[model samples]
Target: MWLEVLLASVLGFVIYWFISRDKEETLPLEDGWWGPGVKSTAKEDESIRPFTVETSDEEINDLHQRIDKFRMTPSLEDSRFHYGFNSNYLKKVVSYWRSKFDWRKQVETLNKYPHFKTKIEGLDIHFIHVKPPQPPAGRSPKPLLMVHGWPGSFYEFYKIIPLLTDPKGHGLSDEHVFEVICPSIPGYGFSEASYKKGFNSVAAARIFYKLMLRLGFQKFYIQGGDWGSLICTNMAQLVPSHVKGLHLNMAFNSRNLSFLTPLLGQRFMGFLGYTEKDVELLYPFKEKIFYNIMRESGYMHIQATKPDTVGCALNDSPVGLAAYILEKFSTWTNSEFRNLEDGGLERKFSLDDLLTNIMIYWTTASIVSSQRFYKENFSHGLGTLKHERLKVFVPTGLAAFPCEILHSPEKWVRSKYCKLISYSYMARGGHFAAFEEPTLLAQDIRKFVALAERQ
Candidate 1:
């Protein structure tokens, strides 16, 4: 009788284990040292200092001199942006930068918001922290950390700041007022570049999490695209408890359920929870999925393997630098922009805004370090990291900008984000969703947070 009781108990336990298999896994929040030379034995200094963006007449003059000497290569006759940035168009842009663009005015614009720096893990981190101009009587504004990706900087969020912090003035409700923080990824802009090797997005996520803790916020929200998307995802995986919500414009989708639904996803989509819109957006798999990835991923291949080799020439020549960075802004904003002679650059952005982003990299001499990030993350291979294999349990939201380089169906996203609260197929935007569609992006963030609050 005793042996029979034990056998029955074991059988029941096995049945329960299968039903509750998904253990709600969590990633280890390991520590890291990103500074140069020997790891300091001393306790790292933790001080938050005020910072301002400044430029000198000498700096402007040097830029002008470089622009004056910029050598131009001839584009193929009748070739649009296909052969890269048409030199004919570049000559026009260079002329504008040298003759009309005012660096001093742009510098003042960058400083209009308060900038701050704090040391974490031996590196001086730079971030712009702006509070709502007016807060409710006794309520604290929601804290949102916005991180920028490669060939981009904290400048990307400048246009979207006011809309988020002071929505009522912009003809929107202020129900979800927020204090926005945009940080330059280390090695991308004002943030200190890493000296020791092996700094990747996971490390960045850990550092930014530390930044939030140091700022005295136990719970906050994170939003990002490009590298920002990956870093934010890692943070959600590492500390789902601390992140109140996770919002993204782009998803890496490297370790998703694509393997389970790549080819037959269209037919099986309903079973996979894909909507009718997902079918339209992700179908014609040859052109839309396979071909699009092949066409758009050349930059990743080179950056992942030989970033320094290509970046050296780009760093030396101002014109070369503009072409490499601006090309991405053009085709990435809308891939069809590649067919336009001028790359349709002015369609959604001003020359001043585009060049200002490029200037951040140029003035800081950070392109090489920025590109090295690709190699650092890819050196070990994609999806090999522990964080990549993990799921983000935090309240998640996705603003699926229609023209994004790659489309992620709700089903695919749901696989990694178990707690996905909201997903929208954004209208009239592309990969640079935040910069291109500030009003829309702000609204989606508000919607996502409202849902999170309700939950």
Candidate 2:
């Protein structure tokens, strides 16, 4: 009995010593900005080697010739059947593109905004930084970062930037102003795609946090929709102190079906003007959007699983590229416009504007690279990580658009985003709220930030 007691006491002492000596894993941030991780010098590279927009006269002429050639070509059976292009009508549209659309003028318009490129995490990231033309006598312009999602570029915020920065032009704001920074994710636009695999949203958030710091913003506000929402949410989680506030047009949660179904069902029914059914049925638009995405997202599956193989094809074929990309603009923006040849795309945006976005993808040759983002994020089952409702302590704002595919009620959003401070049901707009409704979008942002600044 004495021997056994002595042994037990010795074991207890050993275990306690081990436990007390073990070091807890510490995350790097000291206060808001100082993390233990080494700060990158990409910003210095950008300052020293500013990216010059390279437009060769020959390249411009070649593009014009291609437009002319495409204009003369008769509508194909596949194009007419799938794209719903009325043969004669499409000819007229093509004629306009050939004769009226001004690529040089549009290129100049893009150059009007100050564009910059910087290396971050082994990738060159492209962004547009727009500051208000005039600030109030004593106040510095508030910094706002707007992130765009798939099939869209920084062009998405072109209309909104002017409205937010110079409200007199848009007639929406009289006094409020913002200095907005819109960045193209590493894999999109002029930003170089990740060479390595496993790059995901968390990586993007970390790099963007560095970007804000490099710009000398100690604290800033972030706004996003679609994939932008994912990036912004991760930013809040990874560097909540730097992110003074967050605003989103979409919210994603991966909660258990048993808990989520009932809540989703109730809210969806209210959205659809229905009472009871399979909760999934209530969100008809969302279901349709999902189905369409799944059907059209064959490129996503391929890129996610084998990006290199398909990437070669996308990098080669312009027609293949247009079909793959333009299809999303058709379905995501307005499903009713899906069958139309022009996709009723002109109703919301001009052909030049639409082509400008396409040009960004085309010139950068980033279609396959951008698609890899979906694969890196969702293909490995990372998107399905168990949902612990995000505990956000900072102030949050939500702008809910009427035509958005998934509409989250205040209660549902609040369940996950613990510090939701403002909620607005926008009178009009869709998934690309910043692009589709700039005035309304900017007004909501101004209002939300003004409220947050007070807090």
Candidate 3:
């Protein structure tokens, strides 16, 4: 009787172990070479080198010439930003860029943070690494990797870096000071563009993971907003052991929940774990969710199918590039800004800051390469990628900014991030959380880090 009882217990334990092991599955880490030609037989360079943002008089002069030659088109009367960037407003912006906006000053601002580059998978990856000025005694600063998205660069994190790296100086607690690393996605900013095809988020994630390892960090925290969000999530999926925590201002979740949740309606939201705030942001599903997606996603279609087609015009015409990119900044920051004449661009951001971002793309001549990212990501199809299906088991946090393109309920976020530890309904902000509301984002990161550290 004793032997039979022991045998039965052993059988049950074996079954349970297999089930638990199955639940802990991770994505495979594949290798690739994204250089222009064939992979080299020589050992890859492993040295990290210092880099700087440099601009010439010729570059500035060329930009001014393009602005001068930009053919003006009359905007429909009272159309505001309805059609696109208001040509009238464009004139004002051009006047400022040509007269008041100074690229040389902005270049100095870009160089404020220490910059570095290293060859990864045949591409030159550019990143800004900022260490805490004065960390708490007897404590090492936490390493945090932040990534930027389309129409933005590493410059987006400039405002938030000081706050994270030196919280006490910024009137915040120094319990969790950070050593921030902001990288330019390959093909964006100073980073060398991938000459080969199929360089998607997974590839970016792998390269960044290699970057952290090269920088001497065995484990670290990661944060992101747009494309940054997806890449960071993939990093967690690829090497869950190396990622200590993952925090995102934007959540790229499954469409399975996206389609099912809305149909349930507000009455059933509470029953399904959605909060009152979630319902408020997600309700009027047509205007806020459906129509809003359609209205805002026109650029996606263009970029995904034929980025190079439009890239030609944007690359040659600096004014056109500014309009194309700034339109996203205006409407995405707050959709209602579209109803205003100046697109309410100056409400949360200054002309100097906005133009600086545009100039990164303009000077780098990366508009076409950046647009190709859309094609590489979506050229296959959404939700079909392996990473999209896998659940992230790392400690995860989500900050639902009020004015983001879409409001992802905590429930939906948890579907992908199985170990979600923090979900905050941000007080006020939009798509560009770090750039627009640095203090709020920094506070949230600190809050999320505290929770994650406890875990």
Best-performing candidate as measured by TM-score: 3
Clashes of each: 0, 1, 0
lDDT of 3 by residue, 310-384 (tens): 999999999999999999999999999999999999999999999999999999999999999999999879878
Model 2 residue 109 CA deviation (Å) reads 0.5
Please report the candidate that would top lDDT against the real structure: 3
For 1-455, candidate 1 gives per-residue lDDT tens digits of 55544544464455345323445777789888888887788988888899988888888888888778877778889999877788889988998988898888898888999999988887889999999888856878999999888778899899899998988878888788999988888888889989888989988999999999999989999999999999999889889899999999887766653533546446656744678887787777787778877877888999999999988987877778988999988888887898898999999999999998988898888999999999999998876887777777899999998778888887668767888999999877888887888889988999999999987
Backbone clashes in candidate 2 total 1
Q: Each prediction's Cα lDDT score?
A: 0.85, 0.69, 0.91
Error of 1 at 124 (Å): 0.8
Candidate 2 regions exceeding 4 Å error are 1-49, 64-99, 256-299, 339-341, 382-389
Return the TM-score for each candidate structure: 0.93, 0.79, 0.94
Candidate 1 global TM-score? 0.93
Query: Please, what are the lDDT tens digits per residue for candidate 2 over residues 356-411?
Result: 78778877888877888888788757425322234455688999776665556665
Clashing pairs in 2: 304-375
Between prediction 2 and prediction 3, which has the larger lDDT?
Answer: 3
Please list all clashing residue pairs in model 1, or write none if there are none.
none
**Model 3 per-residue lDDT at 345:** 96
